[model samples]
Target: MNIIACIKQVPDTNEVRIDQKTGTLIREGVPSIINPDDKNALEEALRLKDKYEDAKVTVLTMGPPQAEVALKEALAMGADEAILLSDRAFAGADTWATSTTLAGAIKRLGNFDIIFCGRQAIDGDTAQVGPQIAERLDLPQITYVEDLEIDGNTAIAHRAVEDGHYIVKTEMPVVLTAIGELNEPRYPSIKGIYEAFREKEIKVWSLDDIIVDTSQIGLKGSPTQVKRSFTPATKSAGEMLEGSTQDKVRDLIVRLKERQII
Candidate 1:
């Protein structure tokens, strides 16, 4: 069995900055790390690789050159191979454009038993890329997967829902968006880090290699456009009522009544 895991690098919350003019994130010179949810997905893929005798896990990521750091981290964790999709044309991509680019990269990878990705990217916060890739590839997709077992050509999985979880059965080559409930990610050991640092055969693909039309990629292909963004307004001054419990309760009730909340 062969498993493909999609990973992404996102801005560290503390260092995040939005471009005021574009309303998009400013990724340059910012602290970046792998998306937290994708770590769970990586753990799940590594577990499957361990269980299967001949299975191989491949980690792929789409972003600028900076994103190669995230793929290297995946390699240090235990992925058999790593692929980085980087190009100037891939900037400012929305979910749909991103899925298209990733699917194209997957096509280049050829055969695969299963595809795994995190539930969503923290930066975008829209859980659409996985399902969108499934649609583009005409493959089955299971989102919010908490657990999975591969049996021959079938995959038996547990998916999370609004109220509870549901067991699902799907064929091989299915795409799964893993939830954080899957498993905990492991830290890279000394030996693993050494191996990752020494490994010389990393696959890097550019837009030209993938034959992505210039017009159909990057900002041009993205349907969603951001107008502008600004810092939120500051809080206004407010009164603080501190007194006896009875007096405070009465005042609160009167305020609620005045606001027609009661």
Candidate 2:
């Protein structure tokens, strides 16, 4: 089984900051980490590899050179291979263009039985890339997958919905977006980390390396445009009630009624 796990290097939420001038994230100085949800997806892939002796997990990412860090982390966690899709032409791509680029790269990589990705990237929070990639590849996709098992060429997935989760069975060559409930991610072991750095030389692919239409990638290809961006105003502090327990209860109810919160 050939499994591909798509991952991203995102700004650490706690240290994230926006550039007031560019209306974009200030990534140069801030710390970066693997998207939290992508870790869960990688964990699921590792579990599948463990179950199937022939399964090979390959991690892929598209970003600046620093994104190599993320691929290395995946390798250290048990991925058999890592690929980096990097190029100036891929800059400023929206979800549509991004997925298109990824789909092209996957085609060049050869046959794949399963593709895994996070439900959404923390930075974008759009949750569109995974489904869009499936669309581009003409493959069925299962989103918000909490659990998954493969038998023969079929995949049984538990998909999360508003009410509850429901099981869905799909054929091989499918895309799956994993949720946090799937499984706990494993840390890099001493041996794994050593092998990741010593034995692996992550393959980097540029725009020319993959089959892509120059008119269908990067900022020029993106239909969505940002007119302006700014942080929301800080919320006002809440009022504090003071008195005996009974008095405080009465005051709370009065405030709630006054604010129409009840």
**Which candidate leads the pack in TM-score?**
2
| Per-candidate local distance difference test | 0.87, 0.93
Q: Against the hidden true structure, what lDDT does model 2 obtain? A: 0.93
Top model number, lDDT: 2
User: Which pairs, if any, clash in model 1?
Assistant: none
lDDT score at residue 167, model 1, on the 0-100 scale: 99
Give one digit per residue, the lDDT tens place, for model 1 in 1-262.
8889999998986787778777766867889999988999899999998898899999998888777888888988999999998888898888878888998888888799889999998877899998998998899999999888888899999999999999999988899999898898999877778888896357889887775556656888999876676657769888677799999899999988998999
Tell me the tens digit of each residue's lDDT in model 2 across 1-262.
Answer: 9999999999997887788988988877888999999999999999999999999999989999999999999999999999999999999999989998999999998789999999999988999999998998999999999989888999999999999999999999999999999999999999999999999889999998999888889999999888776767889998889999999999999999999999
Error of 2 at 165 (Å): 1.1
Candidate RMSDs in Å, in order, are 2.6, 1.7
In angstroms, the error of model 1 at 98 is 1.3
Off by over 4 Å in 2: 239-244, 254-262
